[model samples]
Target chain A: MILQKISKQGKGELAFAGSLFLLGIFVAWDTSKMVIPQGSSIVSPQTFPYMVAAFTSLVGLVLISDVLRGRLGTPDGAEPGDPFIAPSYKTMAILMAAIGLHVILLEIAGYVVSATICFFGVSFAFGSRKYLKDFAVSLIFALTVYFSFTKGLNINLPAGFFEGVFGK
Target chain B: MGNSFSMLMDGFQTAFTPTNLMFGLLGTFLGTLVGVLPGIGPALAIGLLLPICLTVNPTSALIMFAAIYYGAMYGGSTTSILLNTPGESGSVITALEGNKMAKAGRAGAALATAAIGSFVAGTIATLLLAFGAPALADLALTIQPAGYLALIILAFATVGTLLGESRIRGLVALAVGLVIGLVGADLQSGALRLTFGNLNAIDGIETVTVIVAIFALGEALYLASRHTLVNVEVLTMSGKAWMTREDFKRSWKPWLRGTAIGFPLGVIPAGGSEVPTFLSYGVEKAISKNKDEFGKGAIEGVAGPEAANNANAAGVLVPMLALGLPTSATAAVVLVAFQSFNIQPGPMLFQTNPEIVWGLIASLFIGNTLLLVLNLPLIRFWVLLLKIPSHYLYAGITTFALLGAYALNNSTFDLQVALVVGFIGYLFRRFGVPITPLIIGVILGPLAELYFKRALQISQGDWHILIAGPFPKIIYSILLLVIIGPMVWNFKKKFANKK
Candidate 1:
């Protein structure tokens, strides 16, 4: 059983190594675009990025080596132990949609109105079936924040087009 | 001593104002409630409250937020003792002995001792802060880039100690966060580093956004993806929420010793609470007559570690307030909050804002009292929090987290960043990369780089200054040993085993 657990751990390390390699390649390619000036003792803008890229590449190679040596592995077992396991793809999809809608509507709907809608939808997505409880709480949270920030703290949170509604 | 007393009195006068008191109670109460929930602690609570703080009076809001900061540390111990869920990283030590006591049906004793021990340690640590903070500030005025660099190095070494099981993975996590933290516009040159042509990135990734993503949202994502959780049975109090006379007799020494050890260690930039907590536990175990009771269900183990953790938290403030050094992740966040208020927290802060500093220190005392009062009688009620279904709890967490991140800049780009970081955090967690180092790296990495450059500029490209003087030489020597000693020790052990 112990050996089995160790073996399972190895697979997870392999995937991490692959991800690190990809990240390294992207960083290296992105950083290589910078051209150094003719006469300056100062490091160029890309210097730090290139250094990080090189380090990342080295680490990635180390990780791949460890994986090859079967040192790293996956979690011991693949099983859902809790009733509230990983959220379903449907739930993630709904959450993503709600957030996207909120962002798109933020400028037009204004901070208060858009945030309220965002919270309400997200609350429902979380299986908060008590609509009244969710709405009341979400609105209080959003509006209290709005007044506190915009009025009390004097922060210039976007009032959006519906600034007329709150008279900001 | 006389001046310190007067300062305390003046501090109390400011702290005791009706508005400040109300804010303190509200902050502590909320802090405790949030801290009771697994994985949400003072740092997130403060981050969530930071935008709101921008709307309120800076001193009052900061006072309340600071109250919540330590208050959550106290509250975190409760959950660790009763539910084995460490509400914050510091409380993880508490769970080692605390949960054992709970399973042994001594949950009441464990909870009471932890609460009372935290109170004693917190109160004494406050006194230390009140008296020693000024002197420390005076000393910190002498700090140059050389000292600051050493301090950051010491702080970085904490990553190795706190990271579980695999130090290599922890270092990797720290490196990743440091790289990410450097992804915005350069401070000195005003040139962009790795924003990839995004205008919003010029302002840099908000510390709150990165923190909320990494610890709170990322934690949620990791737990979700894990598809597994320890289902501990909810422990109920079998008796009064007070320690027995015998229990008190045994616990008092450990509490005092822990306070003595933890307070000073916590003042050192590298001497984070975790080190002192372990040290306290070791001391208590070594000296206690009831050593066998440890790991089985020792009250002193819970009492000592919990006290040490709280004391160290209070001790962390000495450097943070006096020298602008953040000893822990929560301390780092608090440092960010101070910066956000345009109040640089260094030696000058004492001269410039005595009331604000003293009032905060005084409020820590009041907040601890309020927390003890709220928690002791309400122990049973808090246990009900453990019954909160994971689904509803995590859902609420996700909502607040998303809302909090959005409010940081009101930019959707941050929300997307949160989602991406959340996923990456989940992957990191799945791969066993500890997240605390990531937090340390993100917060400290930028500051270290800036300081390195600034100091170099001051000395005109003098690299020797980085390791100049007796103090800096000692720091480099220590750093060298820390980096190299482990590898050699491992090699020796392996060779010996082979033989």
Candidate 2:
């Protein structure tokens, strides 16, 4: 049973290392495809990319060897007594989805609206049950930031829905 | 010396303007608030604010940003004392004795010592920065492209070694950052390398976007995902803010010693508050008169480490200001802030924009004084921040993170990039890959490439030119030693064990 758990951990690390190795290969392949224009600078752009690709591949190999040797990069418990607990996938997924939705809706729905929704979504993901309070807080917070950025700082945020109302 | 002194005076004139002072105050207050909050350090605070600050004047923006960095350093100890939860890694040592002191009803003394110690250390370190940076910049001005490339390589080595548990993981994280940095069109050839045919990819990813994603959004998501598991209980403050005379006597020496130890370590490439703090703790434990109180709430433990932590934070700025090299994660974000203002930090920074450079150094003094005032008399007010619910705080952080990314270029594409990078940041955190190297990589990768290519151009594309210079040779030798020193020691240890 112990052996199985150890191997599982090894496999997990191996998967990460393998992906990294593949990424290195992809970088090398992609860099090769880049065409250097004639009369460009003395050194081609490919040189640095090639070096990076080679370095990445070498490091990937090193990581694989290190993992296979049963060496894992363990957290050193800098904050003693506070053992690291991996975050749940459900919460991460929900939060990630919420952020993605915010990004997609940001220009379409506008900053204030998307931000409010994102805030509430995140609050909910973190197990906040007070819907009304969260909603009120999110709205006020988003609106305040919106005005501060646009009016005070003069950075034009996307006023998609509010453009007509704000006379933009 | 006279020139630097007068330059600092000019810096003070700029830093002390009413508007700049107000910004400094705001930054300090905000920095302290975030610093007192669990899991929200200066790096996240700066990342969240970087976009907003971009809209403000460069000098004022940097003044506020510098204030936030110092303020966070001060505020981290508040949580360490009051809740045993350190808001930053540097404050972990303080919590060891600080929380114990709180439990024993000496929380006020611990809190006062930490604040006062930080002020003293901060002031001393700022003085060192004021004096040291100019001299270092003068030296840096003479370094050629090859030497600069070597220095960058040295930075990679030191950051990789110091940041993570394993050098391999650190290097991997750095390489990942280098790849991310290389995604835009190559400046030399104007050839697109890794854009993948997206119009938004042509400009390359903004530093602000990467910073917000990794430090702010990534950290928030991680915290939110683990929200249910980590229960933070705040300890109520009970005593007066004033410390006893005996407490003062015990703390002063440690404060000075910590400053002495922390400043040099901070200036070195192995830049972090953690090492100096642990060293301070050990040194204090060794020399304390009340040795019996070492584990169970020694005041010296709080005083020394807190001082060391703050001094170390200040120390980190020296290399950053002088060399355009960020020694710590927070400094890396600040480096991006410099870029946002079109102010490149390095030897030329001092020569070109002495106002910004010296003004920032001068503002550290102002920020430190403001932090001392805010922390001491208003300790109760700051303690209330601990009572804020984790859900609301983290939710607010993520919302601002998204907004900040969007505000960078008013593009949803940047937000999407932030989200993607944030996810990568989350994975980096989960896997125990040190994120600092990745940040440093993203910030320094282009510069390293620029220098490397410049060196090659100068040498007519000969690789041996990289090591031809005495400076580059020395730097290469140091890199070799740093990489192989541990392996040799470990091998020797194994052989000795066999005997």
Candidate 3:
């Protein structure tokens, strides 16, 4: 069981390296497709991208070898969060959903509504189980941001459903 | 020298006005508020402050932005000393001694030294900036495109090699950023490089979107998934907030030494505060009479690293203000702010817009003084910020991040772009790719390419032109040394160990 967990962790790291290698190939492939015009400045636009592609792909290979030798990368751990606590993927899923909902509802429902939903979902993901209280707090926070930013700071966050409620 | 002093006086007039002072005060206050938090960083704080540019005039906003920058630095030290959870590598050195002091019931003393050390370092560094910038700009005026290309190469090499946990990871981050930066059109040839046929891609991926997403949104999601259990404990102050005379005597020298070590590093393209702070700590530990007390609650340990951190922040401005080269993340953000105001911050800035240049520099000084006042005398009030629940804090960050990104252009596409970048940011955190090099690459990548092309254009396709100039030659040599220097040192140390 312990070995299985260790392998899972190693697999995650290897996948990260794989993604980086693929990204490099994509950059190189995409750069090759760009049509070079005649009499363009002494350097073609492809020069820097090619360098970047080679560097990324090469470093990605180095990382894979390092990981294979049991040299795992160190994540940023200098925060107040508990490192011992097993990360909750359920919470991650909820938060991802929250962000997606916020984006989709932003134009349809308005800044305050979408932000309130996002705020509430985020609070829930963070383990604030007081549902009614959380919703109230999220609503108030969203409304406060909407008024302060839209009226006070002149940033026109979309007022979709609540347009002209206060007669802007 | 005399001319700069007079220009600074003119700047004092602009910073001291009632409206600007209010904005400056607000900037520092908010800077500390967010910076004191463990997860949030100054880049995200600046993103949250973007809408203020729309509300106020450019000069006032610039003043506010400078104040916010200083405030965040001061606030970061506070968290290091109190919680021992450094938000960035720059504060990691401080956590070693300052947190020990806090645990030993010297929280107040630790906080005091950090505040006073920042003041001393900030004042001295600003004075140097006032005098040194014009001289550097004078020199920069003579540099060619090849020289600029060499300097940019030097920055890329140092940022890639010097920062984060591993050299390869840092370099990979930089390369990925270069790829992302090319997502727009080719400005010179008018050819689409990687836009995938979207016309809006002509203007390029929005930097504000990338910054807000990567730092705030990415951080928020990373925190949510990785951290569900609380582990922070803010130590209550047990003694007088003021440092004793003995503490003062021990601290003053380290402050000076730290300032001396930090400013030059900050002015150079290797611009992160992490190196200077570590060097300052090492110097203090090596020279201390209380060598046995090094790991324990030693005042010099706290004083030196904190001062180095501040002086290094100030040192970043020298390159930024003079040559329009951003040596650090804060400098990059400030350059973006200046660009937003349609004010180019190159050598011509002093000639074209003296009011804004001097005023911005002077306001930075005022902001430092304001930071000292806010953190030192009323520290008790600020310590309460640590009690804010992680959930609410991150939630607020997410809301503000999305708002800031959307507000920048009122475009939904940017929000989607932010979400995509945010996911990438989460993967980066999980895998340990440093964000700073990535940011530096994204913002400066296009500029580096432009300089490379121009230098080649000048020699009419002769690659040797890159090695022709004295400045380019010197800078390229430094780049070579930066890449090779550490490996040689490590190898020598390993050999000594084997012996």
Most TM-score-accurate candidate: 3
Segments in model 2 whose C-alpha atoms lie over 4 Å from true places: A1-10, A75-87, B484-499
Comparison by lDDT, 2 against 3, better one: 3
Question: In model 1, what are the clashing residue pairs, if there are any?
Answer: A8-A74, A9-A72, A9-A73, A9-A74, A10-A72, A10-A73, A10-A74, A153-B55
Q: What TM-score does candidate 3 reach?
A: 0.94
Superposition error at B63 for model 2 (Å) = 1.8
| Model 3 chain B: lowest-lDDT 10 consecutive positions | B490-499
Q: Quality of candidate 1's docking, in CAPRI categories?
A: incorrect
DockQ of 2: 0.58
lDDT of candidate 3 over B1-499, digit per residue (tens): 7898999999999889999999999999988887888766666667667667657888898899989888888888888888887777678878878999999999989999999999999999988888989889988999998898888888888887777667878787788788788888777987677788877776888877888888887777778777544748888887567799999999999999999988999999874877788779878989999998888989999999888988888898898889888867777888888888889788888888888888889998999998887778767777888777777878888888888888877887788888988988887887778888877888789888888888888889899988896788899888888988657435422322231
**TM-score for model 1?**
0.85
Interface RMSD, in order shown: 5.0, 2.9, 3.0
Candidate 1 lDDT over residue span B294-396, tens digit each = 8788888888888888888889889889988777777878888888888888888988988888888898999989988888888777778878766456655
TM-score of 2: 0.93
TM-score of chain B of each: 0.92, 0.94, 0.95
**iRMSD of prediction 1:** 5.0
Best by lDDT: 3
Q: Pick the candidate with the highest DockQ.
A: 2
Give residue B452's error in model 1 in angstroms.
Answer: 1.5
